[model samples]
Target: MNVSGIDIAIQKSERKTVSIFIERDGSVSARVPAKLNDDEIKDILEAKEYQIFKNLAEWTQLNENAVEREYVNGQSFLYLGRNYRLKIVKESSGIVRFFRNTFYLGEKDQPKAKELFIQFYKEKLNSKIHPIIERYKDQLGVAPQQIKVMELQNRWASCTPSGNVNFHWKCAMAPIDVLHYMVVHELAHLIHNNHTQAFWNEVDKILPNYDEQINWLKINGSGMDL
Candidate 1:
């Protein structure tokens, strides 16, 4: 589908709502009910034209900071906001590990090193996020059903309508304090569904330095990828 001179990929399903978003690769997409025709989808996009352009501009600005990382010796990757050099080693066990101030990947596994890094981040997020959530449940008056760490295309984290909170695994690569900011951001959504003044107030009450964290993400988010 095409709208406002931009091509959009429309996916129709049994879903009853219509929503549009920009993808990680800068493509536009719309998810609508299967019965909705192309003209109706175009109308919906037309109605949201302003929001779509705004988000596209923001995405462009964020991608300007994108990092090009090569999987080779001496290539640097982030973990807890610290840079670690890549070191490929010849070993029978194909695995990736952080040791001696370097990230070690078995020579045989270098072809899939990005997957290993993702798994490593998931492990770190699993071990770290639960405690933080527990500490804030009382203060925020919201207890989520579960906290999951996974990959997200265009968001750092999200609080589902069911009260479950999911944080992107890339969040584990951020500084501990920054990661906490992301947790608070999603948790605040458990109270406010949208970004209203009340939501900012709630976030401020918990993390007084939330702006710094927000700025950090705006500047460094593109670098969080593999």
Candidate 2:
């Protein structure tokens, strides 16, 4: 069904025996509830269909321009291409800290604080990876013209044909091996402009488990929200 151009795929929920709900992605599901006749089911579904359609319509209208920065406190956004749960902590001193699951705020919980956190994380990420980048470059006898960390909404790491490599800050969230694979992935782009069998061979040369790392990014990358 179309809810203001947000097409919804209706499905029967095998898990829920009875009831219906809308998914976060605008899909609707109707659970076959026990003791429900065709008329009752139709009534229930019609009611839910209207409600879901209305909600979807409103959201689609509101989010036509979703990329425009709407920095709301406590609302999550992407940072360094990774998602870090943001928690505002009020303290007298101004200090920002990144931990396993959350970021702590010290007397400075503002939108700029978010930017600062991103900057600070970039610093840490650079410290963590710069040496490795240097080592790999030296070993391969192929130096990237430039190395930089970035926030890319589309791709994780991109290397210009000129050998300038830009990495997503979210790469830091991956495991050390996976992170190294990401670096190697970009480096491979220096040799092969597109994904080909030769490209896979180059990646395998540097990283044996590159396929697993790529799969990890696909499955869990969205969870790394800022």
- CA-only RMSD, every prediction: 4.4, 14.3
Report how far off residue 87 is in candidate 2 (Å).
5.9
Q: What are the per-residue Cα lDDT tens digits for candidate 1 across 1-226?
A: 8789888888887766777777767888888889988788888889999998998998898889788888788999998888899887788255578887898888888888888889988998899888888888789998899889987777788889999999889988899889888888888999987666888999999999999988887778888888
CA lDDT of each candidate?
A: 0.85, 0.62
Candidate 2: tens digits of C-alpha lDDT, residues 38-113: 6666655565666767765654554443443333435454443455555666662344566675666654556467
Best by TM-score: 1
In model 2, which residue pairs have backbone atoms overlapping below 3 Å?
17-32, 18-33, 82-224, 83-224, 83-225, 83-226, 84-225, 84-226
Clashes of 1: 0
The true-versus-predicted C-alpha distance at residue 103 of model 1, in Å, is 0.6
C-alpha-based local distance difference test score of model 1: 0.85
Error of 2 at 12 (Å): 42
